[model samples]
Target chain A: MTLKLKLHTKPEVPLEADCICPDRMQSLNMTEIGDLVTYHGNRQVPLKNFFECSGEFDGEIDIEGDLVNVKHIGSTMSFGKITVSGNVGVHIGAAMSGGEIIVEGDASDWVGPEMYGGRITIKGNAGHMVGSGYRGSTVGMQGGEIIVHGNVKNETGHVMRRGLIVVAGNSGDFTGVNMLAGTIIVLGEMGIRTGAGMRRGSIICQTKSELLPTFTRSCDYLPLFLRHYFKHLESLGLIISDSLINSPFERWCGDSIELNRGEILLYAGK
Target chain B: MKIKSTTIVDTFAEAFNMYVSRVIITADSKEWAIAAAQSITGFATSVIGCKCEAGIETIIDPNDSPDLRPGVSVLIFAMDAESLGKRLIERIGQCVMTCPTTACYNGLAGGSPVIVGGKLRYFGDGHQISKVIDGLKLWRIPVMDGEFLVDDRFNIQEAVGGGNLLILGKDQKVTLKAASAATKAMGKLTDIILPFPNGVVRSGSKVGSKYKKMIASTNDAYCPTLRGVVEKSELDDGINSVLEIVVDGLTLKAVENAMRVGLMAAIKPGIKKISAGNYGGGLGQHHIHLLKLGF
Candidate 1:
């Protein structure tokens, strides 16, 4: 069964709906689901005032219409799946523990922040701070995977302890900055200060990335272990070209200012 | 039963339970993979004297291997899981780890878990890194060529060991030939290993020895040289040599299938008779009766 939620009216102001996650909506009836509360601008309002819900129910929830003003679309969802056809608001899969979420349109900032488990795939552009920790938080994305097909803004995977973040398109500055431990693979160009202050983690750039001055050039060779990561990403339906799979990478061990062991791998070949 | 005028003796081959683990060693080429496999399984012929029995089961195609490299699947059998675990860790660490560009993986993933790289990671001292891909943890120990990737743990399960047959012939030339043919026929069997040298055991043993200090001694009953002096010599007038092919399999069906192939291959001319050893059902619990070969 599939649950369909269509926006009935475009909100004049931003609406913060924290009840759209699959875990919270899986057991609720259409009436109960509509009665879920959200803040329209500053005042609290029921979800029924903004969206119309229908369809045979299953673990899959489909959200339709432009949700650019909606927030917390799939926050804290641990089970089931959620698919959004149009643009979505901030914190798309914040703190998600399990299951999967697919966004067809662009997603706003803080997508999958501090997620524990599960996977989030965004087909369009993503705003700033995708898969980053909350401000001043020590850890971000303890587990799970976040894959973006389009360009993303800055501060992606900030302070991530574990998990994978894959950006297929260009990324803004400070990608994987202050990372404790995890893997971040960027297929496109990246802005400045990549892997800055990272304690322990890996940032792989398919194209040349703007490396921080703290990073020292190590060597230019193919790390055989990266094949495991490439094959894994291939299994997840990502296109891993033969050239990229066998390409040599320029290794840069960075964040010497913090005396950390993080590494930045830049693709040295086409 | 008679096949090509050779008689199948009316006896049974007794076997006992053992723990088995299959390890797949992959390398940059088939040569290195096989080189490591040979070293890892060396000196492992029989559990009686050698602590374990191990042999290469088959060659894996590069495309089929997890690392997409040429590989060899080897099986090791011991008295129990604990023994198998220790033997696997020691052998793989010393042999496969020393071999260039070789990575070891667990071939039998669904079997009960047994430690492999968990303890071997100490070789790195302090530089080992663990990567978990698709729920399988692999330990990467930095090496000269690159890194040595090995699964954290292998798997072990109950298996059958000591399934064997004796090939009796008029002379050593014919007896060894018949045993060689049988080994060749059963060598391709999956989940089974012929641990003896060239898959033929010349020194078949009995349970006890006349010397009090020894636990086992040569089977004098099947000794053609002792036919004149021994009171219970089982050899016939023309019989001069006897060889055995011991099988250790991960499953009973695998042992049975290998026996069927081996028995048929040993029935050519110059082969006088086919028999098997047993302690009269007092020892090993599983018995493969000769008459049930059904060939």
Candidate 2:
């Protein structure tokens, strides 16, 4: 009973297809769903213009084809699951409170921005601002989890107050800039100024990086609490080595410009 | 009924409703974990005097432990949830936290939550950090060795306690051997603990004493020395010695299961009879009948 959507015609501009969410399609028939309104770059159009919709919604939606021009696929969805078969556009799962969205390919910027709950997993590389707040917003991604398997651009979790963001590959500069409280774990290399201006939060890196001068080295020890997070990430299909789980981490208390409560744990190795 | 040469007395063990909390202590080595477990469970034999009854439930393998360290599980029982919670705080704070290379965690999944690590974090003098992972909150208190990680709260649940078995034998050595055998078998079971020394109690007691201040006194009926003086001695002439095993468990069924296992293992040639302690079924909430044990 999954609702299947395949792109029949590529859109000339980014299409706002927030109606593709499971919450909105659960009660709609094929014809009614096809008639759903979408905006193709400020032009109002029926969803059937560029995509062929089939099947009934049963709390799950399987969407296929390159969704690079499709934005807002599961916006504000409280429950249910959405699986994108290929590359997805920006604003996917934006502000979603519950449920899960899985992207098989790369994702655009602003993945799960300001999300309260739910999970958004990007199997490939992601654009900038992976789980960040929008411009002029006070908080971002209060809860939920965003896991990216590949590399990510700068400002991965900007101003994020809560929730978990795991980047399995390399990340650009300002990884958790202005973060208030949350956990951002970068398994690969990270760029400069990690956790800059963060009031309270945790940024963990597997590989060493040049930390900002605002952070002060505290001590080197094995934090048993990280074992739980490592086990959880391993369950989510991330490859965590046994040596990494047992390694000692150098604790750095940072963001002295703000609350000075944020911490960055750099692996000290066995 | 006779399993071998021993007779299963037609009596029941009176068990009362109590509160229990399971605490898992993990450490860098099994020795340290057992050290903490032994320290916390010390002086906790009976609620009558000790205010709680506790024992080591099992030694958990590193692979099965929460933090992948060598662990020992201990269960503590008190008269009520509030008292049990207080005992948990006192024992864990003084014993487990003081032990080197030890971290404690709540073993039970569902129960009324009692704050333990939340209170212990103050030992860090405002430097303690809290981390919430997968909805489970943990406190990281800075210590001289490194950091002491503990769960924020431990769960306490309603449990059963005071389950007992009286093993009568031809002599003291034979009785001790039989009781040891029974405890070894019962120790293999989960959700239950034999709280006495080496899982055998020599000085079994009655409800009250002739002294006004003493709420409990030695059970004179089964005392081999008083067999001739006492009018109604439970022990016969051949039964010169007796020992008791007290079981406390998270559930009545678990107590019954442990009792059944102990009863079967205690049936030896020197063991004359296997009896149970009860107050005519007037004090406790549950009565475990020996004859009706469908073993």
DockQ of each: 0.53, 0.61
Deviation (Å) of B286 in candidate 2: 1.9
Which numbered prediction scores highest in lDDT against the true structure?
2
Candidates in order have lDDT scores of 0.89, 0.93
What TM-score would chain A of each candidate receive against the reference chain A?
0.96, 0.99
TM-score attained by chain A of model 2: 0.99
| Interface RMSD measured for model 1 | 1.8
Quote model 2's iRMS.
1.2
Give the range where candidate 1 chain B is weakest over 10 consecutive residues by summed lDDT. Answer: B126-135
Predicted model with the maximum TM-score: 2
Q: How far does residue A89 in candidate 2 sit from its true spot (Å)?
A: 1.2
Rate residue B29 of model 2 by lDDT: 99
Q: In candidate 2 chain A, what residue range of length 10 has the lowest lDDT sum?
A: A20-29
